[model samples]
Target: MTKQSRLIFRNKIFFRLWMAQSGSSLGDWFNHVALAATTLSLTQSPTAMGLVLLCRDLPQVTLSFLAGPLLDRFSKRLMMYISDLVRALVAIVFIWAALEQQMWAFYTGSVLMGIASSVFGPARNATIPGVVAEKDITEANSWTVATSGVLSVVGAAFGGLVSTVVQPAIAFAVNAFSYIWSAAWILITKWKEVTREQDKEESSSYFAELREGFTLLKENRIIMALICTSVAFAIMSGPYFVMIPVLGDLIYNLGGIGIGLLYVADGLAFILSASLVGRVVGNNVTSAHRWYGWGFVIQAAFFVAFAFSTNVWAGMIFIFLSQLGAGILLTLGMTILQMTVSPEVRGRIFAIDHTVDTGVKQLSLLISGPAISLLGSPIVGMIVGVIGGFAGISWWYVSNRERKNVSQTSEPYQI
Candidate 1:
């Protein structure tokens, strides 16, 4: 692409959206470290940490549909701004609670942040298509994914360093500031709202509008398959993430620094994979599907390797590849959904997608600790890895068959 073409691809609207998401992601890492540290410091229990995570995801499960209607009813930019503002206030409350030594306040703040996230999730996904040209959508999504990956590494590493040098409360306060900064940047952007007229026509009944999204999902076999695949992926992969800290404490003996390093490793891998895949796949569905299948195979293998590694370096290397695979798969999934779904129902579909995915992760977090306690980390890890591997193989086989069927059907009907 020429310089001008490249510049158009990196349009102002795209940059603004990227900035907002990057800021939020940066703050998210800080929030995670602060929350985990606070709970561990105060309660000194792995189960408590898991419970806190559960609280964070419970709202997604309960309020996801509500979020969809709200996103449909309001301007996405406005909703995003509000979400950031709410999270900022939640962070402030957390800072105060930490200062006051109030445990409940911390939990309350965490739940409130979760609510903000629940609201933000659909709005953010819905807003992406508005900011970039149709031809650039895949690249745009890839950049978004890549930016998030880089931020995750930077944020986690920075959070750990800052938390170690100063205090968790201060780290959280910095996170709050990031939200404020993001909101301000969002306010300066002038992207026109792309409202779904289908949604506007049904404004008379919110529940009816919400039901339409679910109805669409119910009727679409491909979408249903995608959602189910995502759910399975979540269930198989989720507990391992929740178990990272526990792994750090029990298996690695690395503490907060160790946890942060593992996260950084994963994030770095994701960034590299996202960047490469974005260029390679571009807007080609066939290429995306092929890479996604291969990525899953690699991801599952890496997870098994990660489970067996005795050294931090070996574990980090495997975890990095696992995340790389995940990043590619996720980018492909999101792009496919966005391209295939109607704008009218996209918000709700994404909301349900996020809700189910997060719900499975939360449920996994709830059981992971006990499972590890009983089965041992290595055994539990092996089980999860095996399941993921089987699922990946199934996904590849099914997708390949579908691709062949589509090609065969299209041949006779070609123009």
Candidate 2:
């Protein structure tokens, strides 16, 4: 592809949307690191750190179902703009509370920000089809994901650096400004509202719409399998994030900077993987499935390697590999969904997928803390990696068999 063709932001709407998302994602990383640090500073308990994370993910667990139907019913652009505004307000509150040394304010702000993310998740996915050409979907996703990953790495490193030099409250204020800037970009974009096609047969009730989304997933075996695999992967991967700080503190003795470095390593790897996806992913469902399977296997093996590492450099290397695998899987999965699913149902389906994925992560996070406490971080990590590897291999075998069966059945009708 030519350089001009590769430029995702050349399209006016996409440029604006990407800018907004990039800025917001950068601020989110800062907010995430700051929250973890603040909790550690105040309570100095791993359990407390886990609880703070739980608070952030709790909305996804509880309200993800609602996100789909709401995205379907409302204008996605409007929803995203409103979510940004809400997050901006919450960030301001966080800044104020952090400055005042009030822990409750930070906690409350985190919860609100979580709610905002819960709403924005489905809307953001659903808006992509509206912004880019169908053929360029994979490339568009890759560019967006790659940019976000780089920004996340930068933001995490910056947060850590800022925390060491400046106060946490000041870091929070900078985060608040980032949110406002992102919101302003979205407002400037003037993205057109996506109107749902008129369908007299479909019900307007939220429960009915949610049921429809679930039914669609049930009917599409491939999509169902993909989602199940995603849940399994989340369960296997979630503990690493929850336990990373503990590993840093107890094992590496690197403190906040170590945590930040871990995030940066993963993000950098993710960006590198995403940047290559367009050339790798082809125009067929089978190709998508193949990429997804390989990605999972690579991720599982990396996780296993990561669990066995003692040195910080070794840890970073393995973590980077794992993130590269994850980026590939995400790119292919999203592209397949966007290409195969009807736009009308895309919002709800994407939301359901995200909800299931996040719910699994939440469950994993809840269990991980205790599991680590009981087994120690290294052993717990090893167990998760082993399980994840088995799951990936099993998924690959079953999915390949299913694909062959599908192809064989269709072969009889070929001219």
Candidate 3:
């Protein structure tokens, strides 16, 4: 770790939260690896596997009704651990699903876990500024992303290994344990959220609070530009991950282990990009825009390459480069959002972000699942990949104009 990053770990609460989430996130990959492998093993259809992803995303869309205001009005800290606990139970349901080979149980567990994650994500993002100094936010997010990269590799590889040698049930069990572990650590992290006067009055009505947040979309061009970039990435994301399994299983003729290795490559991208991504966005927050565009352009190029790859080795290389770009996009995008939004409306803004991101992604999943059967993964992926490049260029241009406009009209935006 660098001297700058040393400060984040120096805060015990942040450290514990970081460690706990790292473990929890790793478990999430295990669940992902297991779910994909199990679904393929049972159904023998890539479309079915894509539907599994759709099931996981549905709650993010459906439950936005409750997630936004609850996040703002309730203790975000409480929401965090409770989400963890709910997911633990959901994991147990997955274990039963694996044992019984019941597809419904798996889908049900996915929807339940999605509901839990919907709350946890905003709560955690909204909670971060409360834990550390504003200046440390970039490095703090880097470590979080980096550690996730490391854990994802471990989780994907080990989850693959367990599914291949032992059973998918074992992987499901690990996910359960990981959630319990995260909940325990989260309880130890003390998060103090101060309610602003505007927050207090708005707390009286959910729609009023929600409407207050959506108003930012019209008022802030930066948020609008970010939303555009987010949608492009969301479009890429739906096909990108869904097709990875198709690449491993059908194209490369690799089995469960192969699927896992493909994800390991993606995880490695995050680990490789995290430090450099942090440095790029460090202190000079405005720098994130150009880099964000470049990240997407790079990812877009390699995504096409990965889609047509003929061998596992080539596929891994393409996937790694593609996701390296994605890692940059993800880190920069998240940090910019965190730095730009205030605590008063942070949850609603993030909820809107998730809703838009997931909504687009779900459509991608809906199309790609069947398209993979018709046009094949490469064509489906290529179409989306080409669009991503344009999105990157357009988003960068818009953001620059928005920044100039905001600088002219208003006070500066900061976390």
Regions more than 4 Å wrong, model 3: 1-5, 35-54, 93-107, 196-203, 249-261, 372-382
When summed lDDT is taken over every stretch of 10 residues in candidate 1, the lowest stretch is 406-415
Estimate TM-scores for all models: 0.88, 0.88, 0.88
Number of the top-ranking candidate, with lDDT as the measure: 3
Kindly provide the TM-score of model 1 when superposed on the true structure, using C-alpha atoms. Answer: 0.88
For candidate 1, write residues 115-154 as lDDT tens digits.
8889787788877776666666777777777788888778
Which lDDT values do the candidates have, in the order given?
Answer: 0.76, 0.76, 0.83
| Model 3, span 1-415: residue lDDT tens | 6854676558888888887888899899889989999999989998888788878878887776457777777788898899999999999988998999999887778888898988888788888877878777777777777888898778777888898899999999999999999999998778678444444554457777778788886687777778888998998887886788888888888886678789888888888788887666775766777888898889999999998998899999999999889888888888778778777777778888888888888887667777888998778768978888898888878877777776798676552
Give the range where candidate 2 is weakest over 10 consecutive residues by summed lDDT.
Answer: 406-415
Scored against the true structure, residue 143 in model 1 reaches a CA lDDT of 73
Candidate 2 lDDT over 1-415, as tens digits, reads: 6432545546888777777888888888778778788778877887787777777788877787678877877788888888888988887887777677687776677778888888787788788877777767777778777887888778877886776577677677777887787778878876665655546896467778888889998877667777877887789766777666775666778887777677778888878887667666644556667777778777877877776677688888988898888888788777767765677787888888888889988788779888888887778777776766666676677667766677778543100
Estimate the overall C-alpha local distance difference test score of candidate 1: 0.76
Q: Model 2 residue 53 lDDT?
A: 78
